[model samples]
Target: MNFFLETLRFIGLCLYYTLEYIFLLFIPVRKKNVAGEIVLITGSGSGIGRLMALKFARLGATLVLWDINGEGNKETARLARKIGAIRVHNYACDCSKRQEIYRVADQVKKEVGDVSILINNAGIVTGNRFLEAPDLLIEKTVEVNTMSNFWTVKAFLPAMLAANHGHLVTIASMAGLVGSNGLADYCASKFGAVGFAESLMLEMAVQGKTGVKTTIVCPYFINTGMFDGCKTKWPSLLPVLEPEYVAERIVSGVLRNDIYILMPRSLYFLYALKSIFSTKAFIPAAEYLGLFTVMDTFRGHTKKAEDKHQKTGTKTPRSLN
Candidate 1:
């Protein structure tokens, strides 16, 4: 009888939440205030990370920026200060190293206070086929793109859990959801990231930590020089997003406490089809959408554009965040 009652309650909640989601879609949700909040964004040296820092700076949030590129990170801090951010801090820490992440995180807590908003924006992609990709590059991809989130959360989540108030954001990719050709390591890392974020969110809810918010962003390719040579067969449907636009949407979603932020809006429909359709049906759709050959011409960042991207890789493997 108890089980039956609980099942009925779950059914009722499912319907109610469905209606709520549809209703909220038609109207804007109220955005929460981030003013005075300490926001730590990894990979803030350039690309989307830098853009997000500027946006948060404008919104009156204290910015903590991290990047392997010290010069670029300082440049971003300078830009933030130029745009009216008075309390911006930049750190030269490689996300690929766990000890570096923990060390910098401790420094941040002591110097800047507890980070109220943690954005795990640091990531890397090899843009090579599975067999053709170098082993070191694969390990680096996983370390930077997936394992970094775990270390960052471990370093700072205690404070958030204690206070029951904080936001954790992961800048994942659409490749996290679906597979693509020639991006095996990149896809696997993103998949791990997506799973970690989702599971952590569920754990927070299960622990009744209502004030702790988690956002997982899965965006399409962006024109940030990371995927410089990548192409889209359907430009109108899945146009390579602009860095500024992605940064704006991410900040907006964080403020709104959105759990999932999929870029291009069309991704929502496509992802839905993944669950609703069978494997036989999905493969053809993916092929039609050019997922199989999306990375056929991926050139990553050229020498001149490396500074604009987030990563500093060795000569052998081209890495981008």
Candidate 2:
């Protein structure tokens, strides 16, 4: 009876803390002016990245846009300038390459200023089954999604450490927290990203670097062409998030120096439930409830599309998971 009471107390305490955190997250805090802050964003050419870039730019930040696509990079810069950015610099570089990232870092420091914020947002997904996925695709996915964070952090974190003030934001995914079929490579990469971000946070805490904040964002599918045909069985429960909504949340989270930013907020409780329940019970229950089937259908559709493209002489556009 004592143990049961203690467990109840613990659960109640956790619930109280979670509710408090959610309230704080929903209420935006006014931030100090970022007029002179220099911000670098990877994959700033499109989707959530583009929206984030605009958000920062509107706040009078000096923007540095990086994308492998030169045209998109240029367009982002133009938009940032139009949005009232104090300064805008666009670069076309493959973030997956360490040398390229280093080169860009050097140029950014010289051309712009010491980066006050770094958003490691570049990512790619090949919607192929695990076994059917080519080795190169897997390597590239890991390189772009996971290893790029390592390179970007190494290159830019030194300045932040020296200044004793900075923000590091990593745009991870829901796949990192929960596995899904047809997203083996994507899941692996995002999981690595989450691990890396968590470890970095621990290191920062151990070092007593409170001024330097790190935020890891795990959001579900966005309304971008990347996850073109993806569908959820319970659309009302797990609706597709808008890129603008995600961008707004990310901007607000960073300003608040939040440690973990989970979109839709309800997932925090779901994650806790998963942690407390036994896999034998939870897995079968989730499967019977159609959670597994929803993801399986999404994966199967992508696989079928890939197979069809392979049979025909046409290439399918890449889709984000």
Candidate 3:
């Protein structure tokens, strides 16, 4: 009798949540206020990380920015403060190092406060055919893109869980949801991030910490120098996104407490198709979409920067973030 009763309750709750999701699709999600909230952003030196810091700063959130490059991190800090961020803290910590992440996280907690918003936005891409890619770059990619998430979550999730209120955001990639050529390591890392975020969401739910929110953002190639020489085969279908637009979408998704935020909206359909279609069907679709040859001309951030520097005979920043 108890089993039957519990099953009925579960079914009813499922229907309720399903209807609520549909309702939310038509109505605008209420944007939560982050004023006075402490927000931590990794890879905050450049690309999406730096963009997000500026947006959060404008929104009145205290910013804690971390990057491996001290000068670039300080540059972001200066920009954030200029954007009206009342409290902006900058730390030079290598995300690929477990101890460094923990040490910096501890310092942030002591210097700033508990991080109400944690955005694990640090990522790297080899953009080379798997065999051609350097072994060391592959290892560093995994260390930074996958393991860093674990360390940062460990450092901040406890406080969020204790308060039963906080937001965890992962800046994954469309490569995470769909496999592509020349991005084996990158895809692996992103897939790990997606899985980590999903599992954490389930864990939070099981612990009855409903107030702690998790949002996983999966976006396609953006105009940032990270993917400098890459091209989209289907410009209309999968355009290279603008950094500002991508950054804005991330902030909006976090504000709305969205669980999975896939940019281009069309990606939702593609992901669904992948789940529904067999290998034969998905393979043709993937080919037509040009996923296999997307990285043929890949000259990544540092490479492109170095090329320009050599041509111009001038030095410039070269790190991804």
Candidate 4:
């Protein structure tokens, strides 16, 4: 009888949420103010990370930027300052190293105070067939993409829990939800990120820290130089997103306290199909969508830099994220 009652309660709650979501489609969500709030964004040197920094900066948030490349990080800080960020601090911290992340985190706490918004945006991709990839690169991928999130959260979550107010944003990828070719390690790390964000959300809610928010973003191939030469099967269906557009969307989601932000909106159905259909049933559909060949010409940012160096006769520096 207790189990039956629980089942009915779950059904009613599901229905209530479903209807609430539908209603919200017509109504605009109230965006929370982050003016004067401290926002720390990792991998803020380039691409989406850099754009997100500018977004938060323009909104009057104090920005703490981190990246392995001091030059690029400083450049991003300069740009943020120009964009009206009065208090922008840039740190050159290698996210792959746990100790480095912890040390820099301590510096941030001392210099900038507790971070109100933590965006775990540091990530890397090998873009190689699993077996064709080097062992070191595989380990690097996991370290930067997954382990960094674990450490950064540990560094800041305590303060959020104590105050019962903060936002945790993880920039994951659509590949995390559905695996594709030539991204085995990348997929593993992003999948881990999705799980970690969801679990953290549950943990916070269960512990009555409802004021601490968590948002997991899973975007398709973005035009952010990170996925430089990657192509989409269907441009209309899965268009490659621009960095500015992606950053704005992320800021909007954070303000609204959205749990997940899967771009193009069509992916919501594809994810559902994956959940409802068997593996074999999903494969044909994925193939039909050109998911299998999306990465056929995958030449990541690193390779592009390397090629540019070869042509220009100057050594290209590698980024930590």
Candidate 5:
């Protein structure tokens, strides 16, 4: 009886906090207008990056689109211009390459004006088991997902600090908040991204640079071609996010200068539970409860699609099955 009461009390407290968080999230706050602002978005070729670029363009911001795929970059630029961006600049550069990032940053500064917003949205996944993942794949994953943030920030933040105003947004993943099988490299990169954003925020706070806001977006599986074939078992607990929905939230968060934006919000509670509960207790329980299988199935399906894509030189559209 005592144990049951204590558990209920804990649940009640968590619920209280959850509701408080949602209320705060939905509450109207002053937003900085993006009109005439210069925004840089990596991986703007497609998926969430492209969606975000479109949103900013609709708000009348000048856009600088960066991606490794030249054709995709051009297409994003065309789309942004069509959507009413004041100006759209496209650059083809591998974000994982520090030198390439430096070059692009210099070019943007000269051609486009100081960037008022920086979105580090470029990321890649190997979709292979830990042992099967080659060393090169692991390195590339870390370089693109983790190191690229550092390079981009270092390249653009100096100007923002000097100007005393800018928004830095990092699009991390829910996987960073929780461990998953067959995603060791991807998870490690995302976890590093979360840590990097948190540490940067703390540094800014300590330095009293409050005007320079940082927002970290940690979202669940998004229905983008990047995660095609991924599946989730708990639709209620972890429904797959739509790219447009995630983009809207991201833009809203940046406008409001929010520090940590966790989509769905409920995942924060699950993260807390994971931390508070013993691994031995929660891991087995989560597995038996069918939670672990969600990401595992996703990984398996993604791996199969990637294999098929490599075997045949044809790309498959995003599909849950």
Candidate 6:
């Protein structure tokens, strides 16, 4: 096409999408029906994962729950069934292992059929400073929070591509978009998760797979026991989020096909500032917001609880699934 025509078309589309965004602010988008859709959730044993599963169950979707904790996963499945999930399947699969993800994914395909929605919510945090953190724990964090997303998507995306209908949800963190002190490893992993999800979304669009959707969640610290003793500097401005609230927002976002769901609303402005302000300017703002000292009291899980979990081969009671 000629340059003039192409430029005019581009400007027209920009205005069209801008108007759509403004219009939708006051008029809520209709949520899509999820009844009978198969939804798979990793780390479904506890925290936001379990909460999301229950919500989906109530929406009449079949639930496939995966977690390293067999007992905990079973409990989640039981609760899902109790809450009205007609077909609830629980699998004790360690998401940190690529082979395990593939193996369990194959089983899910044969046993439960194609999953229409996939939530990569399994994650772990060492809650240690960069220097003090153990090397193994750092690796484990990356394997679970980042690499596992790659494996899970590869396992199920092909089916979604063929059918051109699927939803991919990434349960990342605000740390993914902006770095925080005392979370070097954790931040790295979540950053990778956010990047991977964004790239996947672009790839789907490039492939003309409009039916396949993606939702990337970047919420501030949630009170899911993962950040046990961590406190917000300004409770009113950036209060620690509740797992129930986060889970509800996530499901709602996915149903509406919203691409990015940053919690607490305030996060939207903070993330926007990251792009507009210089690094030096942003650092002070972040510090004043308590990003630097937020993890000073982050005691992830007590040693006693961890020991009990190790002995019983179950999940740490305080850990977020």
**Clashes (candidate 6):** 0
In candidate 5, which residue ranges exceed 4 Å CA deviation?
A: 1-27, 285-291, 295-321
The TM-scores, one per candidate, come to 0.94, 0.85, 0.92, 0.96, 0.86, 0.93
Q: Write the per-residue lDDT of candidate 1 for residues 20-74, one digit (tens) a residue.
A: 9999989989999999999999999989999999999999999999999899899
lDDT for residue 93 in candidate 5, whole number 0-100: 83
lDDT of 1 at 10: 96
Q: Is candidate 1 or candidate 5 better by lDDT?
A: 1
Model 4 alpha-carbon drift over 4 Å, by segment: 312-321
For 1-321, candidate 4 gives per-residue lDDT tens digits of 699999999999999999999999999988999999899999999999999999999899999999988998999999998877799999999999999999999999999999989999998998888998888888998898888999999999999999999999999999879888788999999999899989999998889999999999999988887887888888898889988899999999999999999997888988988888887887798788887877788888889988888898877544333
What is the per-residue lDDT of model 2 for residues 1-321, given as tens digits with 9 covering 90 to 100?
699999999999999988987787687666656667888999998889999999999888888899987898888888888767758889998998999999989998888889989999988877667898777779988999999999999999988888888888999998888777778899999999999999998888898888789999999888766776677656666778998899999997887777888876766776677788887777774664345654443533345567788888677644332
- TM-score between candidate 5 and the true structure: 0.86
The Cα local distance difference test for each model comes to 0.92, 0.83, 0.90, 0.91, 0.84, 0.92
Of candidate 5, the 10-residue stretch with the lowest lDDT total is 312-321
By TM-score, how accurate is candidate 6?
0.93
Candidate with maximal TM-score: 4
lDDT of 5: 0.84
Q: Number of clashes in every candidate structure?
A: 0, 1, 0, 0, 0, 0
Residue 216 CA displacement from its true place in model 6, Å: 0.3
| Location of the lowest summed lDDT over 10 successive residues in candidate 4 | 312-321
Pairs in steric clash, model 6 = none
Question: Over the full model, what C-alpha lDDT does candidate 2 score relative to the true structure?
Answer: 0.83
**4 or 5, greater by lDDT:** 4
* CA error at residue 74 for candidate 2, angstroms: 1.1
